[model samples]
Target: MELIARATAVVGGTIAFLRRMGSPAHQAFGATPDIPAARKQGIMTLKMPAAEGWKDGRLPVCAPGLKVNAFASGLDHPRWIEVLPNGDVLVAESKEQAGPPKTLMDHAAQATMRRVKAIGTSANRVTLWRDADGDGTAEIREVFVENQNQPFGMALVGNRFYLGNTDGIRVFDYVPGATALAGSGEPLVAFKPHGHWTRSLIVSPDGSKIYAGVGSLSNIGDQGMEAEEGRAAIWELDVATHEARIFASGLRNAVGMAWEPVTQKLWTVVNERDGLGDETPPDYLTSVVDGGFYGWPYCYWGKTVDDRVPQDAAMVAKAITPDFALGGHTASLGLCWMPDGTLPGFGAGMVIGQHGSWNRSKLSGYKLIFVPFENGMPRGPARDILSGFLSEDEKLAYGRPVGVTLGPDRKSLLMADDVGDIIWRVTGAS
Candidate 1:
C-alpha cells in the first residue's frame, strides 16, 4: 500500500510540473486577438482541475456595480435556461451518461469525468421556476417537462415549444399558463449521434425560420469525414415546411448562438480544437454567413492549415475568417443579448458564459463576460461580469457557468451554474 501511494504521489507531481512548464505564453481573449503558433503533440495534454463543491455561505463575486444572488438552488444538473414570455423560467436538468470506456482515450476522458463528478445518471427533465409575487425568488417550482433524452436548447414560437434533444428536435403545443406538460412530442428533425452533443436553437428575427447549431463528432474529423455528415454546422429549418439544410459549415463546435439585435445577423461562440498548445486556434465569435465554411479539419481561423488533416485546397480557399476571437480552448458558450435600455450604464452588448477549460495547462474561463457591440460588431475586449468560480490557486472549481439568459423581468441576467446547481442572478447594485 505504501509503495502504491508513493507511486501515485510521484505521478501527480510529474503531471503538475509538466502543466506549469507547458502553460501557453499568450493570453487568449478579445476581438481580433493574436493566434500564437501551435505547439502540436501526437497525444493531447490532459489537464483538468479537481471539482470541489461550494462551502456554506459561499457565493461568487460580481462586478463592481453589480450584485450577485442565488435565484434558485439544488437543481439537478441545470445546463440550459430559457425565459418564457409569461415570466416563467425553464431550466433543463440534463447530464451526460458516459457508459463504459471503449478505447484508451475514452478511458482517460472517463477518468477525468469521474474525478470531476461529471458522469452520472441524467435527470432528463426541464423544471419551471415561477416568481408570481415579484419577489425576485421563485415561489413555485414544478416539472415543466420530463423524460427527455439529454435535452439542451429550447425555443418557443407562437404556441409551439421546441426542445432540442440529442437525437432530434421535439415540438409541443404550449399553453400560456400551464404548470406542467406531458405526452410524447412530435419529432421535427432527426440528428445522427455525434461527439459534440449540445444543440442550441434560436428563432429568426422574422420568426419564419429556426436555426440549430449542431457540433462535430470528432476533434478534427479523426474518425473520418464520413462520420461528420450533418455535423459541425448550423442548420436552417423552415418553420412551415419542416425542411432543413446546412446554413454554415466547418465550425468545430458552435455551441451558443444568438441573433444580433442591430444587424439582425446570427452570431455564434465556437469551441476550437484541442491537442495544439493553448494559444493556437482560438475559439471565436463570428457573424455566420449562409452556406459559409469556417474551416474545421482542413484549416483554422480562416486560412491557417492544420497539417494533421489532409490538405484540401478547394475548401481552404473558401474558408471565411471569423469576426472575433474569444481565446483558445476557453470553451466559450451560452450567449444572451442585453435587452435595449434594460440597464442604464451597460450599452448594447452580449453576455457569454465561458464554461472554463479542461485541456489547458492553466485555466482560462469560468465566468460570465460581456462584449460590447457597435454596429453589429464586437467593439473591444471582453469585460468580466461575474467571476471567482475557481479557487485562488486555480486548482479547484466550485461551479462552471453553462447557460446565460435574461431573467423573466428582463432587468437582470440569469446564469445556470451546473456544478453548483444554482441559478445565479446578477443585476446592477442599488
Candidate 2:
C-alpha cells in the first residue's frame, strides 16, 4: 500500500513538472503574440481543475468602474445567449453528449472530459429571461424552446428565428414577446456529427444570408479531411434559395463571429489546434474572407507549417494570417461588438468570452476581455473586464465564461457562465 501511494505521488509530481517545463512561454494578451517553439507531447495531457460552485454572496471581480452581478442563476449548462429586440434574453441551455469511443485512448479521454464536467447530458432547450423593469435581476424566466438538439447559437431574422444545433440549423417562426416555441422547426442544413460541436450562427447585415461556423471533425484532421467535408469552415446559406456553400475553410473552430461595424467585414474568434505545445500557436481573432482558407491541419497563423500534417506548398501559400492573436490556448469563444462605443474605455470594440484552457500548466483565460478597435480592426491590448473565475491556488474553477452579448439596454454586458450556471451582467459602476 505504501509503495502504491509513493508511485501515485511520483506520477503526479512528474506530470506537474512536465506541465511546468514547456518550451514556449505564455504570450501576453494582444494582437501580435510572439509565438515561441513548439513543445509537443506524446500523449494527451489532462489538467482540468475541478468545478466548485460560487458561494452565496461570492461574485467575480469586475474591472475598475465596472460592477458584476447575477442577472439570472440556476441555469443548466447555459452555453450561448441572444438578446431579442424586445429586451428578452435567450439562453441556449445545452451540453455535449459523449458518443461511443472508437479507441482506448478515446474512451480514456472521454472519461477525463466527463470528470471535468466538460460533457454531459444536454438540457436540450432554450430559456427566455426578461428583466422587464430594467433591474439587474431577471424577474420572468421560462423555457422558450424545448427539446433542441444541443442548441448553441441563435439569430432572429424578421419573424424567422434560426437556431444552430450540433447536427443542423433549425428555423422557426418567432412572434415578438412570445415566451415559448412549441413547434419543431425544419432543418435548413444537416451537419456531420460528433466532432467540434458548437455551431455559431449569424445573419448578414442585410438579412439576405446566414453564416454558420462548423468546426473540424478532429484536431488537425485526425479523422481525415473527408469527414471534415463542409466543416472546419464557415457555411454561407442563402435565405431566398436555401442554398449553402463553404464561405471560409481551415478555421479549426470558429466559435464566435461578428461583423465589424466600420468595415462591415465579417470576423471570428477561432480556437486554434492543440498539441502544438503551450504557446507555439495562438488562438486568434480575424476578419473572414470569402472562399479564403486560414490553414488548419496543414498549417497555422498563415505560413507556419504544422509538421503533423502533410506539407503542401500551395495550401500554405494560400493561407492568410489572422488579424490578431488572443493568446495561446485561451479558448476565445464569444464575440460581440459595441457599435455605439458607449462602454467607457471600451471604444468601438468587441467583448470576448474566453472559456479558459485546460491544456497548459498555469491556466490562461477564464475571463471576459474587451478589445478596442479603430477603423474596424483591433488596435490595442486586451483589457480584462471580469476575472476571478479560478480560485487563488488555481486548483478549482468557480466558473468559465462562454457566450457574451450586449444587454437589453446596451449599457451592460451579459455573459453566460457554464460551470457556475449563472448569467452574469456587467455594467458601469454607479
TM-score per candidate: 0.95, 0.95
| Residue range 267-304, candidate 1, lDDT tens digits | 99999998777767888889999989999989998899
Clashing pairs in 1: none
Candidate 1: worst 10 consecutive residues by lDDT? 1-10
Model 2, range 64-151, lDDT digits (tens) per residue?
9889889999999999999999999999998888887787556555655554467889899999999988888998999999988889
Backbone clashes in model 2, listed as residue pairs: none
List clash counts for every candidate, in order: 0, 0
